[model samples]
Target: MTDISLEETIRSFNNTGYPFPEDKTIHSLFEEQVERTPHHIAAMFRGASLTYRELNEKANSLAYLLREKGVRPDVIVGILLERSLEMIVGIFAILKAGGAYLPISPAYPVQRVQHLLRESAAPILLTQTQLISRFSIDPDEAEVIPIDLNGPVYTYPTLNLQPVNSPHDLVYVIYTSGSTGKPKGVGVEHYSLVNRLNWMQRKYPISLTDTILQKTPYFFDVSVWEMFWWSIVGARVSFLIPGGERFPQAIIETVQTHSVTVMHFVPSMMSVFLEYLRNSQSDIQRMSTLRQVFASGEKLTVANVRAFYDVLFIQNKTQLANLYGPTEATVDVTYYDCPMDDSLLHTIDKIPIGKPIDNTQMYILGENGELLPVGETGELYIGGVGVARGYLNNPQLTSERFILFNPQGLFLQKPPLDPAKTPDNNPPLTESFKGVQGGVFQKAHLLYKTGDLARWLDNGNIEYLGRQDFQVKIHGLRIELGEIESVLSRHPLVRDCAVIVKQFSQNITLIVGYIVPKAENVSSGELKEYLKNLLPEYMVPNMFVIMENFPLTPSGKVDRNALPDPSGLFGTKK
Candidate 1:
């Protein structure tokens, strides 16, 4: 095999999707929209709407109070609240006060919330009157400011507080699920987030008349794009009321009532919503106002894509986009627009994750860091501007995952450059930088190892194979659980499914499946036969259990840990 030059390989996979100036921070861009469309509705929750000016003023008031309490550059502020207008305000206020906001979801367990508060070490916390009692922290440890206390904090005058940080300063630190049984905080700078938001606006423009639905919890990175992207473009953001996410009818009604044009969903939730549409016999025309639907956080199966196309896009002009990214890549890094052609849909087993977005580059690398060929499967590494600033307070873990990559030996001879002097400089060194203080200054470019197995297609698209760790070996044959789940999802009666390896003994393990059936009468025997046709016998699950609904994490993805053990269950034989 001929060796491909590093420059050629980089040029082949890099995507300059849409270019936008990165000179401004999120707060500055949001203020520009406020200046242009002060009267436009910026956000709405529970029958209350705040114009751009009103929202800015509320945010400014909170910022003023925060500044009085020593919130400044490099400071970390915690936000604990429900899905309400104040939650949005808290986000902007933290940015305006020159601090990185740590979102603590109200739905999280008390111990988990306490862990985040203690791990992040956020000296200041913003919460409402109702949620103040939920915190397990002592008042002496962190100053708690309740926004709805009917005090001067709420009635304080609104003023423009000049942003004190540069584009590279930390904007937010979001905690994602870690395999080590603890949540890791990913610190994303303003420049990385602004680039993502600008690309979304350019690719799928949201007009002032459009309303975006904010149903995901604020703690998740999906909400980062959903809540702020619309505001940056002067579009209205409609918040979903409490308990609304569990009920499909409530979401549908909110979409119809607000004429929501844009929305995002995890594939599991999307499957449920589509099932609701089919079972209720609802008119697709009523949902015609929805022009674009974005799916991410999980694999978008071919069957779910086809169902969405047949029910929503077949007679309307809506477009379904399949996005792929982890929390470390700032929400999304790649996108694929599902075509309406049934022939094309039938031929593919799994939808391609599509091309990289603007200022983003993806590479499939072998175990030894060599570039893999188009059809060869390897681990996916993300580079370019969207790479996060590494995990907060965990430098060893950060250095392990966020590696330095110089494909062409371009920086081999150059001396180490200070991170503070880099063109896109982040905040000054903090506790998170303790372990890497001396070494990080020498790197040329940081690439985040996604730990996901994928391969490049001939058409320049990437096909995601499941996580590298999710690959299991049974009876000397390596199997990809996602492949099995994909085949099961294609069955007419299977709405969603999850596959796990259950170890019955020290040397023996069995593949078990948990499924949510579309029809009550669907049988596991039929699903086993369906799998036999599509997958090898070794790859097929040994047992199948039907569930009314799969348990979900706070981020809306299927919770694998909550799956019940298949004890005293009979195995299916081929």
Candidate 2:
């Protein structure tokens, strides 16, 4: 199709009846892609690259090896690796072995990581020799399989393991930082993943000639899509080492070197990229080969968005977007292909995440569960294939968040089994679940209560109004204070901890952790040092406060409301 025709086709399809794949299971799609493009470049990590043929063979071999070791269908396996060629192999190998992969970031606290591994009951842990010390459990407790990409030294046995994924078979369980508690594992089914991958390929259309880049840690769900989707299309997916934060220059070099046509980044990282491009010695402004630039994880501010088009898109004519969604939804639910018209620039306050992608349906609802009319403010509830099955072992919390509703009846009901057990046809929960009466509706429509607040614009797009809770965005990163508290409370020196999103500036929110130390002698510097090893640098609190006792509210709860503001207490205002 001609360029205009292709764009028109995509727009028309989305406007009319956008056809999604019937087989939602990842196994079938994975098999089909491997069969169709065996010799095409499936993925690239630094100097190492794998063709579809090699990836399939390697996965098949690992599958057989895993089965020989007695790993079976429905089993969960922990994958602890950085963004590398081996990580991709481990994922497909787990799926091929009829098991699911649970991504555990090596940077996570050993205690929390161990909690997730034990909570999920994953039987095997996959990692590299460099990360062997991060495993929290004894090797004897669960199988620890260290991937020796360079020195396995022997051919792996080959076997075509029949795909055993029921429509509900688990694919991967990703633990999102919990704002109110420890990190909770969000379980995604094979079909949900398949639907997402299929939709992404159809919408984004990365091809054999496209070279994609995997920048996020493998533990992040977006990385999962980065590796597999490119594999399906025989596209090259380059890897950025973990230090891409410190060496944005190297990332630019890699993109230039590989002639990368497609890349994904969080808004914070995109800022870093745009900053690097503006200041760099390399004339990135002239590199017109880059085609697609996708950003998510946080809103793309007006200034940053404009700077992006001025430099990146003006040069490359690339697609720029503010893709939106939480991990509970599969990577993204909506995308707004950014507009570049100068006339519309002044009126664009917030880039709308645009419409729901493919099968996903979004509802703006009032506090009472009623569907807010257009131009009304309400919480955003998402539905359809992009919605996750639910949290991995926390049924109460899952049921609380993922509700069932009937659009026609406007009723809400608590789901009985895991939603994964039920098909999507349980009923269409189109309206928001509100009030006590909302509990009676039980068709198949699963309602995902996104904590985000949004309002419909007169133009039919939704504008995000930030969060209703203490949750806040820092450096364009979405963080839940509960998640920080959960991780901090686990520290031996911390007797009690409270984490809150304290905004020091209009653009900056710092994670302020207030801790009651086990002893009076603990120092804030020492606590920061301890957290540096236990969590991702972003998750580490920017400032620490040691308190002998927390203020109490009338309700007898810790009075977080009474805590001194960071600007006043710390003398550090953003």
Predicted model with the maximum lDDT: 1
TM-score of each model, paired residue for residue: 0.78, 0.85
Ten residues in sequence with the least summed lDDT for candidate 1 = 426-435
For 85-132, candidate 2 gives per-residue lDDT tens digits of 787788888888888889877777676667777888887888887898
Cα lDDT tens digits for candidate 1, 175-222:
865544355799998878997987788788888899999987777788
List the global CA lDDT of all models.
0.79, 0.71
Root-mean-square deviation (CA) per prediction: 11.6, 7.6
Cα RMSD, model 1: 11.6
Highest TM-score model number:
2
lDDT of 1 at 69: 85
Locate the minimum summed-lDDT window of 10 residues in model 2: 409-418
